[model samples]
Target: MAALSRLLLAALLAFAAPAFGLAQQPAAPEAEAPQVLRFRFKPPADGRLAYRIVQRDRVVFAGTEKARAWSHVVEVRVGGARPPDMLEATITLSDVRLDEGPADDPYYLVAKTLEGRALPAVLHDSGAPVETAWAALKREVAAGLARHTDPETARGLAAALDRLDPEGVTVLYRPLYLASVGHLLGFNTDGSVRSYDDYTGPGAVMVDGRWAASAAGRREGEPVVLELGWRIGMDPDAAARALGPVLQGLAEAAARPEDRAAVKARLAAELADGMEMSERADAEYDYALALIARFTHRHVLATAGYGKEAVLEMERIAP
Candidate 1:
């Protein structure tokens, strides 16, 4: 009787095993490699977003040096119906907390215009910025140039801007450009640097008169990280020769002839020694790769045994 009861219990256990998932089952297949950083972005717009900015720099001369750093926030708004593939936004940078800042910095003084100012920032995946959007930013910059200087000086400044490389401007100086377009930059998850043009073949870099650059990618925690940088290329002699007329013009507008000569002489002395330039733009992004968590674009140029480094960073504030 006991053996029969035991047999009955064994049969009952065997019958319930499949229902409870206790039976042997085939192993699940392993997950395939992720298609990392293939840009399938859905631009987030029609709302408000805040981004924090941080920048730092130091100039080293022989044994003496100068360094500075600052951080602030900018609020962006893009209303109306959101586009499925693009974002058009206006950024307002005014009345925000600056967690870090430096005193007696001329560049900072000019950049202060950033606060309380509204600027156009657009994000699209055209591989290059649309002409209209580029013109919009250039217009804002042109307006600022006029507001800050005499007509002659403004014209000189505009000339200087005209001489500037669009690629360099889009990369480092224009915060809005980086904020809106950095994500659209091409990246490779295998840590190989390639040209922005996908058809350019592997190991090739995007080249222009001012820069030869590309970005590499890797996984970092929950975000995709990209390491991008520039190889500084400028002939000091060429630069000095080009800068003399602009400086003289500006000085003519605002200072005495002697002052103008003195300024030109000073700048010539400064750029006399050719510089070696290097830069880095490292960025990290979340799941959708929508926004960079932290993006730092830094440059260090060495001349006459001295080095000057400038750094700029942008971070998105958590909602």
Candidate 2:
């Protein structure tokens, strides 16, 4: 009887084993792959977004020099709407302060001139001169200079402006362009990767949450930061027709003998230390058009071969 009882117990235990094993197994719903975060622009509702942009520059004239920085508080707003993919936006400079440079520094002067100015919304892709915006900024700079009571200070500021002429306005206004359109250059309507070559190329790098020109070596902290407070959609072609006046102005400028001579001199200087002028018939108009084309078609952000960086940081200040 005992042997029969043992056999029955063993058979019952064997039958329960498979059931216990099944119960112990954990069910996994599914394994999902990690998603990649490709860069793209998502516009906010139509309104103003405020941001603080900071830039640091370290120049080594002899030995390692001290780092310098400047900042601007800007308000950005959508000026027009282009659903889904494109938009137009304006960035206005509300305030500016130089944190790291001497008052006489050219960089500091440039920062001072940028305060209380509005960078009008314009097409990033449009190969057109931003004459209207440039004119407005020139006036703004002049007004700022007029406010300075000190003769030396005023003269220094004026000299700085002269040195940065034509290019100075472009440099100052470029931050607005980059902040507004840098990310858009990375995408297309079909959701394909757009070529960086078409815009800024490999001269820049995305840092923190913003784009920066690539640095030679890692700095202890970010040297530049562009905190984007807002972005929204706008019409892509609205600023295209605005180029008419600028083009007309260019035509007029090209007709001037002095302007033509200046272009030739500049071109000659760029070719070599002592490039010979061609004795052939002077193509002044052609030279002017070439210069305009070169300037107008340039990337919104300046390209650096190496040893430079741009750090962009985006933040939302409004719903």
Best by lDDT: 1
Q: What RMSD value applies to candidate 1?
A: 20.4
- The best candidate by TM-score is 1
- Clashing pairs for predicted structure model 1, backbone only: 93-116, 94-116
Q: Relative to the true structure, how large is the alpha-carbon lDDT of every model?
A: 0.44, 0.34
Candidate 1's C-alpha runs over 4 A off are 1-42, 80-87, 95-107, 111-114, 117-173, 179-181, 195-208, 220-273
**CA-only RMSD, every prediction:** 20.4, 25.3
lDDT of 1 by residue, 73-117 (tens): 767665443366555666665543323433423234334434577
The lowest-lDDT stretch of 10 consecutive residues in candidate 1 is 197-206
Model 1: per-residue Cα lDDT at residue 25: 25
For all predicted structures, in order, the TM-scores are 0.54, 0.42
